[model samples]
Target chain A: MIMTTTAQATKTAPTTTPARSIARLLLHGGTVFALLALIVFFFAMRPDVFLTFVNVKNILFQVSILAIIAGAQTVVMVVGDFDLSVGATSSLAGAVAASLMLTGVPIAIAITVALGVGLLVGLVNGILIAVVNLSAFVATLATMTSVVGLAYLVTAGTTLFDLPDGFNNLGQGRLLNIPLPVYFAIVISFILWGALRFTTIGRRWHAIGGNVEVSRLSGVNVRRARLLAFTIAGLVSAIGGILLAARLGSASAVQGGDNMMFSVAAVFLGMTVIKSGASNLGGTMIGVAIIGVMSNGLNILGVNAYVQQVVTGLIIIAAVTLSSLKTRQR
Target chain B: MRIKFKIAALAAATALSLSGCAASASSSDNGKPLKVIAFTSGNQTPVGAWWVKAVTSKAKDLGWDLTMIQGDFDFQKMNPAVESAIGRGADVILDGYTDIASIGSIVSAAKDANIPIFAMDSSTKETDGFAVNITTNQQQIADATVGALAKTLGDLKGKTVMVIGHDPHPGIRMRADLAKKALIAAGATIAGDDIQKVKSPASGRTEALALVADYLSAHPNGLDGVWVGWDDAALGASKALSEAHSNAKVTGVDATSEAIAQIKAGGNFLATIEQPWPKILDKLVQNVSAYQKDRTLPKTKFEADDTTLVDSSNAANITPSDKLG
Candidate 1:
């Protein structure tokens, strides 16, 4: 009788779940729909310039840095932590990498060192939040301030220049008519998606975030999971810094600071999409694309740049609020 | 037991309160000096350094306490900095205006407070409420740099020259437009066909390096001379070209230390238009001092300095570093 009851419960669960999931889909799916509408509208308005091959390529290239940073931000947020330091870390990594290249260091060695610096910063954040018992918000904010100061100190508050020709190619070169940075983003996103969806470590992260005390009682090694999440975030952010430096062909203290908040906003807005309240890699890609398209579209339409920022902020807030309401109802 | 706990809590609270008060008092009472506020943007740049030096040097001479506020090139921050200076009863305000339109509210507020503001570097035409607008004649500087570049190039009739600068900066844009006009009038063909627009780098150094590399790769033989809208841009371009082993002659406005050094290094930077900031700052201070002594001192717009073309021969004579606000 117990076996029969279990079978019945399983059979009913599938049927009931679809209805609830459909509502969630609408809540999350609306952002993608809106993005598509905006793209079509802009294309129709300025078919000549907006839909050109070069412009499309340019949009992807421009959005690559923002997308990579936003992807890391998603992972940080999934673990119920915020990383305000990602932007500063990116700038530090880029500045250090460019300075190394300017000093005739090999590109590969400079990249490795840059990634190591990012990891060290991440470890500091993880220790502060997990061991010292400080809130991630406050801990990351402190790190952000210090990292910016360190970047400024490293560069002596000046832009590093005269990078080798090879480094400039990273910004200007194209393979099969697609930008190198775009390819980098795609490869990173694939690995991130696999880790988040199929790995045991991913489960642990979700469990710890869902309920920290419960996971600890369950012997889930919550501290390790949290640390790993942050470490991964740091590694990805450093990669973003490297690509940004390559694209700019030089690095300065303020290189990536402007993109930090926007990246976070993109990640938050991503959570409101097809995955509903859940942070998913696919959702992040869509979120990044939406932002990229809108920005490019507005630029093509000749709308004021400042007005575009205002519109983007308002749309992100609205989408997230709607998703939050749906989650509460469920 | 409860009374003992309460006593301990009270003692801790008292200690905290006393420490807080002590910290506040020390910070507030370090000096009761007259406050003079100076506002500019981007602490890392040479311009920021020049402004700080000029303001502090003048303040020292007048025996007034100076507070330097960085606006980060945001006009939004400039308004609040001015308001706060007024709240602090600041004796004088020295500010850089990003745009003439953005300073209307700040100017009106300063007028209401009866505080004299000395506009530096950039200014608005609305001098009715301000003390003085002391600016380097940017149009003249642009024309001089282009003219110098044309002379060096020798028959720029069919040669393509690239003009690089920041278009959002009004002063920079004004100078760039003037230079373009001057170049065209001199029979030089501007490179506006392919990558003709001013390519501003996300960062100055990157822009400079990319520009040099890209320009050289595209034009191997080096067409006409390259004209930069600013000295720093020229310096960056020079660094890139030097690294690439290219001999493209470059010219720019603003005889900054780096630009002069590049010229001295024989990196193909022919000349730069020099603005003597020290002399300009003295004129600014003189105007402000006169206004303070007598409110009726005639409100006047002073063209503080004209641009001079400094090449390798004369670059050595120009002071590489001087305090200018």
Candidate 2:
């Protein structure tokens, strides 16, 4: 009986290997394939405009701020926690920076204070979850609401305009004809990717997310790691908010709050590519790119905004479903 | 000793209760200041901010005990605050820059409390919830803006234009539809065969910039004119045209400071419509003060004020709407 079973297993191994390889390819390459397909499809539809250099640059420029915020989200998500306050933090930080400048505070000082605010919000979130034992969702949600209220208070329930030109240059200025925010997005994405891929702290965060008990057994400071994750997310989100205010030449109390949902969507779209199904910076960037392409392509084709929104919803669902199925298979 | 302490506490409580009743009774007396509940969900917009400042100043001048509520576009927060204020008792309410549809429950609550509610730009057509709804005539505004665009383009026949709008805003929705119809009737083709709807007012500038830039990328000479529902988005469209070096003249409503500056600078911003918000507020205040003097309501349930067309000729003369306060 043992000999016969061994013979049969060997007989199936050859055929099953190819099948598994195909499945793996489909699971890991789905987002990339979709992104490529979208580009090709849009290019075919509008041969005169879709793949042009200017349009591509426009897509990058449009997604830059989202990329920064989404990158911040990816950091928190990797540690098996969500920073729901990112968007609110962004709005508050931007409003603070702008309000400070209006009140005659030096631009650099104002920006530093705004970043400090973001860090402070993150620390509070960290303490709530890591030290106080509150669930991440509840803790961040509470902070998000409070932060938004603070944003309204800071701006006096209005949009803040007439920011200094020197500060606006940070958002609007160009390097060789490309917008400055785009460079910030690229640089920040790279730094996040590197940190996640290499540092010991990054490894510990991944371990804690994978299994907290095992991570603790392995001597990792699980609480401190999680706290660090929330703190980093807050700081990065603040950077994104400041850039957004500069880019728009104005800041409203709820302006950066709109980025929250899109950041989550981008992160979810990005998670499909990793075999481990872990949230990753590369995947998030790809996710952000997919959204930017879809929106830009649809607009170029003159599709209705409502219909475009629906299509985006469907794409996110499909990508997430694929990732979920792959995880279940594992 | 405990019984004596309790008796003293009871006496103190009774004295405080009497004082509270006296304060409450004074607010309702005919000779006292008019207790007003003023609120809006759109306090973040430029016009909405203007309304807030203007109403506060007006209330102070009128010596009305005002309970100002800033919704910041959150109905969940604004509604409850308004309801609580109503529960506390008020002589009248002022709904500024908030759509009636969003304040239905608040209106019903105010009605139950027997308080009259006055509104400014709450709806395109007069709705039943408000005692008086005064807004700019969206159709007339569209007519004037489209005419300006046509004149700038020298002719509308065979010209291509884009009408951008946000549907959630009643006034913008109505005027955008009217503008599209007027554009087509004048033989101009609507770009993409429809209006480009913006998802959020907060991000209107970037979205508008992308729309114009992408459309121009595909059709280098295809766009001749753009009519945006608001100035923020129109300024974005103008910026895109400048970048593309396209002579596509843009028209916007709400002659904002940025739009006025652009118009004066002689770029693609052709004209903007300045709704008489200050004038409308003045009229609403007069009626409210009259009602405070004696129980009275406006003669009409709804009123649409005439809007001015601020082209380069008048752009310099008109005060920007953001600074209207």
Candidate 3:
């Protein structure tokens, strides 16, 4: 009787153990699992189209600009600060660049000036938040409002189009049948990931975000780190805005304004997947991928755009809740 | 001393009588210029900005005392500004490119002040407050766009078309609905079985591009055409078709320069409707001038003008709507 009972217990333990481990993994990496499940579900539902090469490329191309903007937001989030002005910064840069080109400014010069505008905005934000000790939220909000006004002023409340071909190619041009923006997104992501993972400044940023007081006492130069984070965010956001203008072959005051909310949401969604429950570049990319996939899938399925939004909001909530529960378990 | 006081009273009465006569004359049209308050909630938009410039120029030509109030799509700012301008006194209030529904407070204030509001592109239907509102015919615009799609596709029957629109815009929403019904009536199937609504006008192009690209990815050759409510989104749809090497035709309203150029290039962009904004504005200005000459309002409370469809044949001749002075 003892031998028979032991045999049954051993059999039950093997099956239960694997199931428990799988559940734990899914709980910890909720965003990643959710993304995988979404992809699989879409593919299963539309086997011929959802997983096709062109469709995959389409998804990547559509998300390229978003990936860059979300990455910019992630940089700020890493330092425990987020900028609400990234969208406005992008729009202002694009408008400035486009208007300059219209006035016979060389494309190179216009693009450089645009990057400068972005850097300047970032520096101003850093000064106000880091140097003046103002709240990042309030300071960035002020900058966002000012930048939107500037965008309108630069464009004179008109859409600027018919850009030079060379400049348009930055957005619409393709390399080996892949959109240039896709390559830009990938390179930017890698560079950002490297900066966060390998560089000494990256470690300092992590420390500062982990514990501001401790990092300050340890001579980590918290102010400079935080300032740099904001500046980088501004610069990256500008790149995104410029690309968006290129893609459309036009620049308008409101063109890049919608990225702010989406980028913040992507960063928040990304935070749930990491064990530290902190924002990371990889997790942000996954978050962006998830959003891009959901949009593409729903569009392919002919779902109402409004309903897609509701579904996305629900997924975010679910992912965060699952992550929170896992944290409680730990 | 009594005689001097009697003389002073006689002089005062005479002066008072003459002043009253002058007041009566001024009130009865003694060539006083109209005090005009031109308000627009959409002054940040391209067409809105053009309206501001055009109205200002018109007011100057008519020698009207014009105060331009740009709302920048903010009712909170615009309502109070219009109310203040009303309080300060205006002969007539001119509203441009702002939905009448959004300015209920300003309308109430105008009503209280007994000032009739002349509006341009403010509403599709006649509201009580507006003396007259002139806007483009949305149903006509839809018919033209959908007709272009049908013509390009060779036949509407058994064809698949996507109707893209931003629902927040009343004109766009109405036109999109009309276009969808027209497409179905013509025996074409609506892609996604509904109008694919763009969430925001600011991001309409990007969203439209994604919407088309995604749909094309699944049914690469399934789509015959795309009907967009505005030119910006049409441009996006055109780009998607271009990238995919698809022969699907695209049509849009708002004869923006880019849309005209696309039509001229004979690409995926097949046609666009020019709303004749300048012509509409001129008519409104004329009506206002008639009112200034004699206290009069338009006989019709709501008027919708027909738009010109700019396809390949007439694309070159039509001055792009964006370039209007």
Candidate 4:
């Protein structure tokens, strides 16, 4: 809701003009170029450190949770809604799940209950925005505050650690030489990509984003569609929280607390890519990859964290610039 | 803006309280409520919770009225918290902010109102407002911990060490800088201390896991010892070292429970420096109460707390006998 809509994209309308096609290619293609260029730059600077297998794994392992949440953010944005409560929901979910596990609940039950908490938070958000007709921004922002408060209330701001070994393995486990969370991220992104690209529900969501009233007149359940987008956001954030709990081997009031902005940043970067760029899952994945590589590569190069924040601000500007170019092309 | 209203409200209360306070410094203990604003909720961690609990209990024991307001980690929240504190018209205020810079304006306000501020953790050396700053000798603590690292390793000259330190809080930064300096002076080569930067101390485990995973992948076993800024980071690095199949010894400053557990379990952690926060809390409370009666604040600007260096040989002694449960 906070993002300025540059150009209202018409999905499924094939671009016929050559100049338009060229402009679209340049704008969307720049992120791809920036990503590849960053990889090459890091490799050139620190071939032994950056180009190695272990470091590469570390980058992907770092990328997995952000990608998962950003992929969810992509879908939420496509339906003309914003889920600002994503991070808070994830924190609450993680804290509850960890506390439940420590008290001798089965790990599966604990995790399921955590995801269930996410679902309920989503449902409340959906009811407020859809039924009560609250602004998506206000509804989600209100939920964000309450949910964060609930997280601290439940855990009293303590870090819950020493989860059973099975949960640790979920975070650390690898299948077919890839980390477990990486596999989860891949499967989730592709599924979201296919659903957004191929399905009727997905197209209707694009229709809603393009123009909500027109989509409503065309028989789309705009309210229900927006509600579903939020629910998916909740589930995805919960997954992020669960994986983060496993990865860190502990859950705190802030385990996944700083990710909403990262997810939003990724989705906005996603909007600058490809075929009228209606927040595609593919573009969002690319955006997440860019963040992962930049941080890992910079850390490997021993750039100070303060300098790293400056570099990050610069990249966001570059992404915003590309998005403005997309607007100019239209 | 908040300070404006706070001072205005304080003026009203000062009018009301001046008569009571003027009656007698000794008779002022009519159990009139005093206010306490913490950096954040003490319940944020076992140690943090311990601070809150100790203060609350001490207040109850002394028959003093205590109001606890949990501020936040953001430095921006410091002034607003101070304003809220003034609005409450408390006799004395305790400043628990990790950064002393944020408390500067409040200290001025407190001084104008003839209220005393007992700044906790943050060094008040250059600051004039603190009645007494209760803090550790962070540099000396770091030097002792890392100097022991040099002693244990038998020679600092060629041994590789990684200094994992946090950089946000000035007090913590001082300790990290001192640790790094001591390690380098001892002849140890400092490797990558590139753990993720944390806004609050509670998330050290999360950052430590990611940082260690990445760093250990890059430099498998060149490190002979790990010097962390706090015991949380030490505990985290020990876990990471164990995960990566390296047994590099770890030494840190906080005697947090998890770090002690690591030491008792014979993990890579070798030593930690224990800060007696509760004892400091008791002294701060006692002195603040004393000041309230006699209206006499401390002559000393900085009151240094003692820190104990505990290795495996003395890990049990360092264990928190005062359990929260």
Candidate 5:
């Protein structure tokens, strides 16, 4: 039986291997190459401004929020599940935190509540998918719509501003002259990387993602693993929202929602790197960086914002397609 | 038991009829506490918040209960808010109409409910049968900015002046158009191709830096002067100049606190048009109160006070900070 299965796999592998190889190259290599080329182009276009340390710092600071949100998104997508509501969850958390702070809630307590709200949102998503047996896509999409509606209800269609000084530091504060948000992203990514690589729960998520029935039969407790994955995703998303609120010094109902689709695109693109079709933390980080770089570089190049959105969407599609091709090749 | 059932049915019918009559009477009443509903299109941004503050504070003073509804700038939320207010027998409704197209339906609904609607901040020249439309005079703002820029540029008529302004919003577009006309009249060669129209401040600083850098690199001598349509844009442009070491004179309308600070800091920002929010609020209250006293008062159009030019020379004379509403 093993011989027969191997022979069948070998026969199918030849056609798929080339595609996978190409996909891997495009997903992993394309962004770096594009970024380098953009840098060169901008340097030539505006030598004084584009090649400066101040500009680089500015770029990183600008993309820090996207990186944080995209990193959280990467974790969720690893188990072959998507959380559409992450953006709304982020917005809701930020708005709620800002509102609480306005009401004289201590920054720490406000942040805790904001994060708690995110976890609760995640729990709902996990229950809907793992316990109630709903499709991840449908469950998350519903949550996204509901969460956005809830944010509007909370704010009554107004922005929450005049945030406490301490809250602003999370986004603006720098350690050793580096932005606090950048550090926050690094810490979160490392924690996620460690958990996914070293923990049994993380291994179980991958196992269930690869084959639910087999994992279940092998005693993986698939439902629980999926639930845990979703819960973690929610927590991370909430953190992303809080960071955003700090950065902007205010929170509006739809502030985080604008970047939701972009973060998901990054996750999809991330799947094409390192381990094609497998959501690896390293690949996701790279994916986030690529998106950040593109946005930052384009803004530095004076590209129109409308045109920037178009370019971002196209790059994501190209990256994902390349990754799929590489996987097929292998 | 059968007689009791008949009497009970008759009582129920009478109650329903009486309630319906009372609703219609309240809806049409001239002196009955006329329900006034106000709808805004965003969870309060500065502009929306200021409007809310002004209207609600006036409502308190008038001893009126104003129903304020918020919409997330999406028509889905806005439509429901408008419908709910009309349903609640709102006799007079104040709305900041974000979309011009939605005004027709809103106007129709208010008319059907025998309500008079007043729109603030946003205006529809095509709107008919509305009580009054209150908005900032874009021309006056443009004139103020252009006059200031011309004064600063003085005799550099043929020099290329870059106009940085948002073009998507109708109000912004109107200001830009008026500014363009004024620049042409002043004999200044307005560089249309070099014009940078930014949508938001999310990446405003970066965009400003890049545009300024590119313009300086390309032109070598830098722009003669920059005219921004709004205060925030001016702030971004000012940062770009500071970074590029270019001494381009910058002028902007909407004298926000930050803009005033930049002017005070001795940046090349020559002047800013400060819209007197207090005057605007006072006018809004006056018009609202007048309408309340006489429902048949003709629709009035009035321009609020002009922009207060704040250049480095007279920056000290202006109030350092004023609450917007």
Candidate 6:
């Protein structure tokens, strides 16, 4: 119903000049162009460190976890829900996986159980929101608190660093000069992009988010849809947590606590880039790269770490403002 | 129900009277009541666990009445923690956090209340720490490490070095500052413009890894040595140097097991100045006890923890920690 109104509004809207359309396109692709400029500038300044294959690999390796979390966040945001508990969910999963590994659980079984924890948390989040009718924010927040507590409980309030070498290899191993995590991130994003583009469940989420009452009246199975969306978010958060623990060769109660900010920031930034003014897997990945480059590049340039933070905050504000430019007209 | 209620009231009254006697006894006689507000909660279990264990055992050893408050690493939580400690009628307070600037009003308020505050790991103020200030002589550690780096290169006359540290507290900044002075005194050039400060211990490793890589990129083979204030920063710098295959030597403080193991394995990490943190806590407890008996603060405001320089030669005999000790 909301899509129909949007279609009508666009049809009735004033026509734009070819020049104006091209200008809009250029403005929309600013992030892509800005990334290129940053690369060229850094390369000119430091060829050996900035331009090397190893550094490129390092950037990919560092940002790989954030990129995966961002993809998970995009789906939930598209459905007009927030999973604030994802960071804690990741920590809980990591704690469970690492602890299990130490207790002589096979790596394969331990990882599967770790993923199961995420799915289970997602089920709880889904039930609390879709069936029990709690606001997404309040529900996920409750889970986040409890899950963080569970993380500490599982590890007995200490960091677990005594992981088997095989698990460490998962975090550090590279295939064909690329880190294993980078592959996981790329594969997850592509799979999500396909689902969002080609599936009915994915497309209907826009309708549900736009007008939930109308979608329910139109037989949209609103509860089931929301439940599935949350489940997917939880599953993906598990993947991110497991990989992060694997990469660091350590898991602590605080492992995934700060990732919510990164994931949320990346999704919001992606909205401005996609020109759709909504979350998309492709756009989220691009946003992740922009953030990754900014962090890696600023560090490479010998900028004070605090100054890097200021620049990042300004960039986030600019992104939100850019996305709002045309929306203000509506 | 009425009989049970009467019994409960009588029990609470008796308990209150006994508690009153206990509080007055501790206050009037020996200074046995010490309330400790730790920066990290015991639940954090990794970063601030040792401090908790040392202080707890020391409180018992000194026969002090201990009331512990966990700060949970939050600044806002501290004001209440302080107020509660004051409310508990503690004779004195032991603190592990160092954000004196932000927590100044609260600390000053405690001073106004006549409850003296003793700080741990915070810089020594000659008159500030009511009992005695126990702090690590960070400059000496920094200088010692820098001297090691210079010795490794045979001479520091024309070499270049970088000092990497986190500036969450004054001690870390002091260490980095002293390292720079020593490097310059040895006729070495300071790499880049100034010391690279990490934001905190939480992300210290990642930040160090990236910043060191950046520094290495800018200077290439120009850097001769690197000095880090803490083990995490040292680990990060060591990784950057080793991965880059640079010839620069790395030195750091805190003989974290990983750092010792790395040094023993002949990795890029050269040497670390070890300050056994428990020793400082032990001394702080003793000084505070003596102040109660004599009614006088120490003549010297500060007591320093002894430091050991750990390298491949001595790493075999030292214990290593996976996390920063």
lDDT (Cα atoms) of all candidates against the true structure: 0.71, 0.89, 0.89, 0.75, 0.71, 0.76
Evaluated at residue B32, the lDDT of candidate 2 is: 79
i-RMSD per candidate, Å: 7.6, 2.2, 1.0, 3.1, 5.7, 3.2
Judge the docking of candidate 6 as incorrect, acceptable, medium or high: acceptable
Mind giving the per-residue lDDT tens digits that candidate 2 earns over A283-313? 9999999999999999988888889989999
- Tell me each candidate's TM-score: 0.68, 0.88, 0.91, 0.88, 0.72, 0.85
Query: Lowest-lDDT window of 10 residues in candidate 3 chain B?
Result: B19-28
Could you tell me which residue pairs clash in candidate 3? none
Evaluate residue A127 in candidate 3 and report its C-alpha lDDT on the 0 to 100 scale: 92
In order, the first chain's TM-score in every candidate is 0.91, 0.94, 0.92, 0.91, 0.88, 0.90
lDDT of 6 by residue, B228-313 (tens): 88876787788778767897888878776667767877868899977766666667666666656554556676566667889888
lDDT (tens digit, per residue) of candidate 4 on A274-319: 7475677888888898888888777666676667768877887888
Per-residue alpha-carbon lDDT of candidate 1 for residues A85-146, written as tens digits (9 for 90 to 100): 89888899888888888788998898899999998888888888888878999999999889
Candidate with more favorable, higher DockQ: 3 or 4 = 3
- As a whole number from 0 to 100, the lDDT of residue A322 in candidate 2 is 83
lDDT (Cα, 0-100) at A153 in candidate 6: 84
TM-score of chain B of 3: 0.91
Q: After superposition, how far is residue A329 of candidate 3 from its true place, in Å?
A: 6.2
Candidate 5 CAPRI level: incorrect
Docking class of 4: acceptable
lDDT of 2 at A259: 85
lDDT (Cα, tens digit) per residue for candidate 6, span A112-216: 999999999998999999999999999999999899879988976666766787987787677997879999999998898988888999887877876789989
lDDT of 2 at A215: 94
Over 4 Å off, model 2: A1-24, A100-110, A164-166, B1-33, B80-90, B110-114
Residue pairs in clash, model 2: B41-B73
